[model samples]
Target: MMPLEPVVLSFGAVLLLGLGFGSGPCNIACLPYLGPVFVATGSGPRNAWRILLPFTAGRLTGYTLLGTGAGLLGLIVQEWIAAPWVRWLLGAATVVVALSLLWRRRHRGGGCVTDPASATPTRVAPPEIRMTNGVATGASPGATSGQAQALLPGGLFLMGAGMALNPCAPLTTVILAAATSGSASAGLLLGFGFGSGAVLVPTLVFALGVAHFGQQLTQHMNRWGSALEHASVGLLLLMGMGTALGWIAP
Candidate 1:
C-alpha cells in the first residue's frame, strides 16, 4: 500500500487543477457540444438543471473510470487515449449524435417556426396539416416525440461522459500521478475529487448562465429560430468531423 499522505497531496493538487481549469479551459472544451444543445433546446434556468445534472454525473463517471484504469494499467491508459483509433471513434460517435438529432427533427416534423402574431414559439402541429413532399407529418416543426424526450437524459449523460474522456492538461497530469500511485483506491479518490471540482464552474455557467441567456435569445430572436436550430446542427456536424479527422485537438 502506498503512503496515504502522498495520495492526499495528489488529490488536493488535482482538485485545485480542476477548479482552476473549470472556469476557463474546461468550460471552453465543453461548450462546443453543450452549447448547441443549450441554445437549440432553448434551455432556461428552470430546465437547465435537468440537462446539467446528468451531464455532471456522466463526467464524474468517466473520470472515475479513467483514474481506476490509470491505477490498474499504469501508463497504458494514456497510450490508449492517445491512440489514433480512439480519436476516430470519439469523432464518429459525435457525428452519429449530430445525425441522430437531425433525423429526429426531420422525421418528427418538428419545425420551430414563430407565430408572427404572438412572437411565441410553438411546438404543436395542427391536426389538419398533413405530410407534404417528405416534410414532417407528425409533430410541429422541430418538436420531438415522447420517445425522443425519454432519450434526451441519456444522451446528455453520454455527452458529458464523452467530453470527460477528452483528457486536458490538468486531467492528464492527475492521470500520470494516479498511474504511478499503484493503488486503485487512491486513483479513484483523486479522479472523483477532481471531477467534483471540475463540474462546479460548468454547472453555474451552463445550467444557470447559459440556460438563461439561451432562453432569452430564443424568445427575442423567435423569427430566426429555425435558422438557429439548423445552424447548431451544422456546427455539431462540422465539429464531429473535425474531431474524428484529427483536425480538432480533442
Candidate 2:
C-alpha cells in the first residue's frame, strides 16, 4: 500500500510538472491542431467559446483517462522501464525528436508564417431576412452550412482529445512512474493534476485567439511560434542528453 501523504504530495508535484509542460510551445501541440479546425468551421467569433469549451473538456477527459491507464498498468510499466536498455532507447528517441524538430525548423523556415489571405475568414455576414410564421421573405444563398458540423461540440471535443492523445514519452513515463509509486486512485489524481496544469497556458492562448480572430493572434502564432518551438525542443534535448549520461534515473 502506498503512503497516503506521500502519494498526495507526489500528485501535487506532478501536477506542477504538467503545468510546465503545457505552458510553453508544447501547448502548441494542443492549440495549433484545434485552431485550424475552428477556423475551418467558419463560425467566426460568435461561436468561439462554443468551439473552445468542448476542446478543453475533451483534453481534460483525455488526461483523466491517461492517468487511469497508467495507474492500472503501473506495475507492468515499471517492470518494462526497469530494463537499462529501455531507458537508453527512450533517451535516444528523445534526441532524435529534438534533432528532427531542429532540422524541420532549419529546412522549412520554421512554420511560423500565417498567410495573410488565410487569416481573414471567408465567412460572409449572414444575409438579413424578414421572417414571418416560419417563412423567410429574403433568404440569401450566401450562407454555407457545409462545415457546420465541424463547428459542433463533438468535433471540437474530438480535436482536443486527439491532441491530448498525441504521444509523449516524457509524459508517459511521468504518468507510469507516479502510478507505480501509489494506488490507482493516486495515479489518477496525479494525472488529473498534471493534465489540469498542462491545459492552463494553452487554454488561455487559444481562447484569446478564438475570441479575437485577427492579425494580432496570427502574428503572435507566426512570430513567436518558432522561438517557442526551439526553446521547448532545446529543453527536451537537454533532458535527453542528461538521461543518456545517466544523470537522472529516467
Candidate 3:
C-alpha cells in the first residue's frame, strides 16, 4: 500500500482553499448568513454543533460515494492514470488554481472566480427568512408556522450535500489521482479528509466565539474574511509551487 500521507496532504490543502476563503459554491464564507438563524433560536452554540456535524457528515457521505465510484472507473484504465505525464497534468492544475485566484483579485476585484472546487448547489436557505416576532423562523407557502426548527437539520444537510453536487475539474483531478493509486479506499479517505476540513472552519467559528460575540465575530470575520481569503490563496500558491518543484514529494 502507498504511504497515504502525501495524498492526504494534497487533499487537505485543496479542501481548505475551497472552504476557508472562497465565494464559490463550496466556500463556507458564502454561508455567513447562517449565523443569524442559530443566534435567533437562542441555541446558537448547541445547534451549531448539532447541525454542523450532520452537515459535515452529509458532505462526507456524498464525497465518499462519488469518489469511490469514480475510483472504480479509474481502476479500469489504470495505465492512463499511471502515466508520468499525468502527474505533470495534476501539478499544472494546482498552479492554475493559484494563478486564477491572483488574477481574479487583480482583474475582477474578487468577483466570483469559478474553480474545480465550486460545487453546484441549491441555495440552502429560503430566498429570505421571515422574522417571526423577532426570531428567525419561517413556514412553507402553505404550511403552518414553527416549521423551521423541525426542518433545520434537513436544511443544513441539504446545504452540505450541495457542496458535493458539482465536482469541479480540479477536485475531480484530486480524486482521480487517488483512484490512480489502485486502491479504491484512497478516494474515500481523501473525501473524508476534505469534508472534515470543510466543516472545521465554520464549526469552529460558530462553536467557539460566535455565540458570545455574535456582532463582534460577524464584524471581525467580515473584515478579516478577505485577508483570510488572500492569505489562503497565498498558501495555496506556495503549496502548489512546492509540489511542482518536488519539494513536497513523498
Q: Report lDDT per candidate.
A: 0.70, 0.51, 0.45
How does candidate 3 score on lDDT?
0.45
Model 1 segments beyond 4 Å from truth? 1-10, 107-144
Residue 194, model 3, lDDT: 60
| Preferred candidate (lDDT higher): 1 or 2 | 1
lDDT per residue as tens, model 1, 98-207: 66556555655433353442533443222111222123334443344444554556766766776778867788887877887877898898788788889889889998
Q: What TM-score does candidate 3 reach? A: 0.44
**Candidates arranged by lDDT, highest first:** 1, 2, 3
- For candidate 1, which ten residues in a row score worst on lDDT? 124-133
For each candidate, what TM-score against the reference? 0.80, 0.52, 0.44
After superposing candidate 3, which stretches have Cα over 4 Å from the reference? 1-28, 74-148, 168-170, 213-250
* TM-score leader: 1
lDDT by residue (170-200, candidate 3, tens digit) is 4555565666654567666665656555556
RMSD of model 3 against the true structure: 14.9
